[model samples]
Target chain A: MRLPSCGCCAIAVRCRFWESRIDMPLIEVDNLSKTFRVPEREGGFLAAIRSVFNRRFRQVHAVRGVSFCVEPGEIVGFLGPNGAGKTTTLKMLSGLLHPTSGTATVLGDVPWRRHSEYLRRISMLMGQRSQLQWDLPALDSFMVHAAVYNIPKDQYRQRLDKLVEMLELGPVLKKQIRTLSLGERMKCEICVSLLHGPEVLFLDEPTIGVDITMQARIRDFIGDYNRRYGATIILTSHYMADVTALCKRVIVIDQGRILFDGQLEALSEKLAPFKVIAIDLDADTDGYDFAALGDVLAKEDRKVKLRVPKGAAASVTGRLLRELPVLDLTIEDPPIEDVIGRAFGGSSGVGPEEETSAAESQGGDR
Target chain B: MTAVARSFFAFLRKGIAVMLQYRGEIVLWAIWGLVNPAVSYALWSAAAESNADGTIAGFGRGEFAAYFFAMMIVGHLTQAWDTYEIGHLVRSGEMSPKLLRPILPIWEALAGNLSYKITTLAFVVPMWCLFAWLVRPTFDTSAWQLGLGLIAIVLGAVLNFVLNYVFALVAFWTPKLDAMGELYFGACMLWGGRFAPLDALPDILRWLSGLQPFKWMFAFPSELIMGRITDPSEAFRGLGIQLAWIAVSIVGFRALWSVAVKRYTAVSG
Candidate 1:
């Protein structure tokens, strides 16, 4: 094998060395495990009273032997369904919860140790909870967080103005958090989280319960923040729109394990080998067997969609192009949600047939 | 020095701003504080009037008012309920955002507690004055007694905060902290010296009560103010007891905090 030149080799070695030292890995996780000891409760007043004396605990492994590293300035979307340990992983990284075993490091510090240096440099925003004190204006909440974060006056002002301008908070910053609409409050939450200019931003469903327009705006701002500060962002969201808009790479985890980790396109290429084929036939055709080409994903009024295995797609298209009086035809990769669902063996929503088709489609990637 | 003072004043101003907004809740809880003392006052006054000696249990009607009245304000300032609250947050996966902030949750809680006192004292001060005017209690205050009273209150507040924090740390070990709350409240209410002076209880009970950290929190402070411990030597001894409890609490807090965090289930974020 041809090797790199000495100058290039030196740079490569230096990069490897830095990666090894991990003085400041934007994100680092090593064999991390979190098992929740759930109290076993049986229905009835007797059991409740008995629990007072004979407490029984059963372990639920929420996260098991998970390990990964994220470099600075990288936007990695952690994808999983409910009970898939996605939120658990995010909590561990943000130091909201400690791991039962192994280690995790952010900015060269152990996360659960609650070191101030690490905390000052990172911010965690969850879509379901209000970090800002409610019953107060966005501006008031921002002031409180600014104090708690110990943000310098000048930096706080500059960052606040920048966020307010970007998020269009001029009209709503004065409104009480309770008064603001869901979309509006989400923006304000993001603003407060970023007020201190954190180097690492952990967003757990940051756009959940947001409208399409607000979601798009928040996604755009996240991209902007990353571009401006080179901040390392680890975001967890169930919505495909979030990952599609902002992340190039995604980590698919389920049942406390990482299922897939790579580029977004690579995910589809590796898991979904079938390209969806759309047909608009002039003549009505019911009971048509497109499964000969691959598997049928859906159909609507003279229009049909079939996911054909990658190699067969072109050949099948040629046959349908020749045989049917097709009004229009199109080819595209399956939806990311479908591909991800298929990757985790229909855990999200994809069915067995679709998973097989997606699996075959990914085989075509090779 | 000016810069330090200015920045401190800035924190103070911000603290005041936050305090005023929660002033409503603070006033409501202060009303709750008034309840127990008010009940005790009525009960003791009735007993004093019915007594042939016209003095029930070494405390006359006015003396009972002074004792319970002082208690109302002191207990309010020194109370903490975060042990169960924090546990609930951790168990329900709601505490992640708090851990993410640069400030410790304890620091924020402490600041909020201190700020609440500063604002709510408005009503507390006024109510005390009105009560004192209505049934004036003759106070015997020398320079030493006044000094001791102030010191006792301050120490009591610190000791209360530290002990409450120690109990809160238990949330890391046990998720069901409501039971812990019940146990702590029961112990502190009786042994903590809030109901009556530990000294007034029978010898065995009083001695056992003395071993408890609660009496130093409220009993000694009320006694110092009431001039019950007028003997200079005894007053010094009371101060010593309060100081010793404070030391035990601080030391216990340091040890408990680390162990509790270690045992913390480290809930899935």
Candidate 2:
């Protein structure tokens, strides 16, 4: 039996595509699925050769019935825990992979068809791979792109000069690609990718391996580029700062499905956002049995901590102070990463401060 | 017409600039260029020296040297390794930016191959001349033969480009295409007269090899240069076959490219 086709389906409401709750999303996907057959192997050299002839195949579904949408010029972050099919979805959108079943349309274009006009409108940068030739200087690579993109010589020069200045690629342009550092190479790659001034920028961890300063620089440049060109940006990174700094809306996927897709602040509130409110009481206070209020996180000689829903934080904190002994109280936001970690069946001790640096580095891994 | 040529040459200039930066690797590649063909020539020359009748098939020692040396030069000039390259580009999603451009990807690949060939030809020319002088074959160098040789070489280059590109598109389907690449080179080495002339093979093998485009790439050209295929009828058939293969390859490439692109989605799920 054939699987049902559900095109770019998502539960998120008031999306950029939905102006009056009746408008369709600029990008839509429905019941999208992709499965791959990987060979099952046995040890031994002879067996390896035998397997090559009589291969054993196992089907692994990378994306299963997942969907979402973005409006023109809206910067959206495609987020997910590791191996949650973020890259798989991005590849499908970029026309790099065929969906096994379902539908995906970007600005009304079926990406896999590789329509010439559609191709000319978008560009993708997968962090681990570079488009520039390894034997060439960045200038030479840029020149090749200028011709391929059919950029006028005059316009090419102006855009190149601006990119060089913004990316600080002057020191690296003349150097062979092999001689350039990782950060330097990434800068050149970005410059090369942008030569055509593409309208839709699909950046998959374009900042991976770059230094913190370089990461921030790239993010700023991305913002500036998007503002100047009004290009739609779809970025995927493990770094929360990337989403917080650049994207107002985020779609978080887990196990090849959309676990949460909405505004970043709204998602935070929807998930467990209230930090464990810990109160240290006077030494004279009797043993506080506060298990009924919420999940008790910890207890010390004079301190008691409680984990509660974001909506109940104010009332619970007020009640605790009014009804029981309380000396000091502190409230904070729970780390999104930690909350996501638990939500995805991953138990961890990720503090809130670590999210920024972790997310910043994630900028490099698409 | 003016717009296309202008754009092509602009990209070609960029291709040359890119190749210039690999000067260090160029030296290493030159060393490989000398060593690989030299070994093949030496081994076959040794084999020919052991011929019981002093002539194995139609090739004597002198003729073998002349033919192999010419084949080596032609092979170096016409070779393309971009198939493996395209695979990497697809897997890593680097093909994205290239596709984003106005020009087709094949044109860029062709320009890249040309840039590499012209740079590396410096080494091929010297090596060819050095080997030719060592294995001297007393021969006439008439203007007709020289002109025909020039034409044949140009035809050989075109044939090689078509063959390589047509197979390179296979990378779109076959991820690990090293075996296919080796098979292609092996065919050229054995039947194309890159190792020894097809005439030197058994009569049956010679007949079959003559039917191959590989023969047009090397054996046919070497024979024309030597003024062997002087009969107008035979020369016409040889040249015509080369053109036919070019036509076939062009059509084949157009069809294969569309099919191959259908399979490429840009990334592994």
Candidate 3:
């Protein structure tokens, strides 16, 4: 069999072909699982000493039977709380960790096999890890990355210039990475990872630890990269805004199991089957009961907020308008944060039965 | 250039640049490399001087000086610390980034080893000359011996690096490997003839040293350069042993690396 050429033209041609196949999935993962054998011992001098002689280990199933397909040029968000196997799944897909069982293929190659061609075509950006040389200037690290990926000189220069301009990294290019701010360092990390124009990007918390503005800026850059290069991206982040902004589809995982997978708006509609209605009453009716209409979320002097079932939102609004002297009213879906919080069974104060009843009620009303 | 060569040179350039940033630290490390051979020379020379015939195991004070001086240079050239470093890289999760690259991480590490040696040469060369002048060691080296010895040193460096890297693969299984590094260093000291010449050792130790590859790494090159091995066939045999070890080490590295990466937990992200 002939080996593929590692060149810009080859990558461009392959990317265009993959991009043209809109229906074909660029990445396919099937029943993928990773179990880590971690040594455990109680915290104490005696336990530590005893454990040295009689070591005990427990299996931690970081990722359990995770299976997802990502099409070309799509950005899919991997949502979860800490230790939810978000990073673990990304690691396995990026060829950094071997899955204990199951299989994954990215761009027609098994990822864990780690063929040089497969590695050259993909990039993984770990927000907490620094791939650059700490004491050297960011530009130096970029040059090294270019060489490591075997990028042609002209193409390397052109891409470097484009990335520098897009990332606004001209000023910080010559500065040592250690001296740069956390946001600046992250930008440099992104810059180096993209120097090869990888077709697949596994970004684990790409916007983590940055300020709000920086996070948004990084998100924009990532979106722009995906649009321009037709790259397939899998991103994991704790910030709901990141998911809401970049990803139309999200996979919510918890405790090594995928809880939900669908459109972002659909997640809210399915998981949090309620609409928040805020009303500016014209007059304060002290004798009126708001709970009869829906769940009273807030009752201030003039303004009142009600959490009405999605199916009954219109009826509740009509009743409130007829009974109360309302000045203005607006209905909106619950925040993504709240929806995800409820998905994880967090402190959202809503029980599983309420969620089930809400779904049933919405279905029946529809 | 080919992709591998270009990547190697790039890593070498970055390694050299990083080393240049710590001039004082590099000089200190270079001096530390010298101190071991110097102390060994002193102890052995004193022992030779106290002998009835001013000789022990056919080596007088001057012969001991020559042996140690050559050993110092040989040791410096053959130095590798992956055994000490791999554990830290594994524990701190620094190896993950390197593993992501298309090339093997060992290329970058080899670049780092060469860069350190290159950067420290300026400080160490002058110190070596000073040591030679102070010790006034004698030399019986021929042109052919010197040429073959230089070739041996290069082979010895390759052998040492590959073997040490293969051993360092243990870090993937057990991340805390400082004791392993110490054991490796101790073995090299005893068997590689760094602490004392192999012939001067007791019969059991001398016999044991010949059984391992460390003798080919440090002892053979040092003895060859000092013109102690007069037989051409013996010198060739030593080179053959070094080549065999190099091949074994490369195979061992490939075998261990395939398994080690699978075992990597990638601890901290």
User: What DockQ do the predictions score, one after another?
Assistant: 0.37, 0.40, 0.56
* Model 1 clashing residue pairs (backbone): A272-A361, A272-A362, A273-A361, A273-A362, A274-A361, B192-B214
TM-score per candidate, in order? 0.82, 0.79, 0.86
**Tens digit per residue, CA lDDT, model 3, A190-300:** 999999999999998988899999999999999999888889899999887788889998887765666666678876666778889999988779978889888888998
Worst 10 residues of 3 chain B by lDDT: B260-269
- Tens digits of per-residue lDDT for model 1 on A1-366? 222221211212223464553123456676778898888979999999999999999988888766666777989998877777888888788776778887776776888887877888888888888776666677877776767666778998999999999999899987878888999999998999899888999898999998989999999999999999999998998777788789987877766766666688786576777788999999876666776777887788888898888888899999887877799999987775576666565674655455434433432231
Q: What range of 10 consecutive residues in model 2 chain B has the weakest lDDT sum? A: B137-146
List pairs with backbone clashes in candidate 3: none
lDDT of 1: 0.75
Poorly placed runs, candidate 1 (over 4 Å): A1-25, A40-57, A273-337, A347-366, B1-19, B22-24, B265-269
The regions of model 2 sitting more than 4 angstroms off are A1-25, A42-54, A272-337, A343-366, B1-11, B27-62, B83-103, B265-269
User: What are the interface RMSDs of all the models?
Assistant: 4.0, 3.0, 1.3
Candidates sorted by TM-score, best first: 3, 1, 2
lDDT of each: 0.75, 0.73, 0.86
Candidate 3, residues B1-269: lDDT per residue as tens digits?
A: 89899999999999999999999899889999999999998999999999999988999888888899999899999989999999999998999999999999999999999999999998888988988888877789998888889999999999999999999999999999999899999999999999999999999999999999999889999999998988888888889989999999999999999999989988732
Tens-digit lDDT string for candidate 2 (A133-166): 7876778778767765678889999999999999
Q: Best by TM-score, which number? A: 3
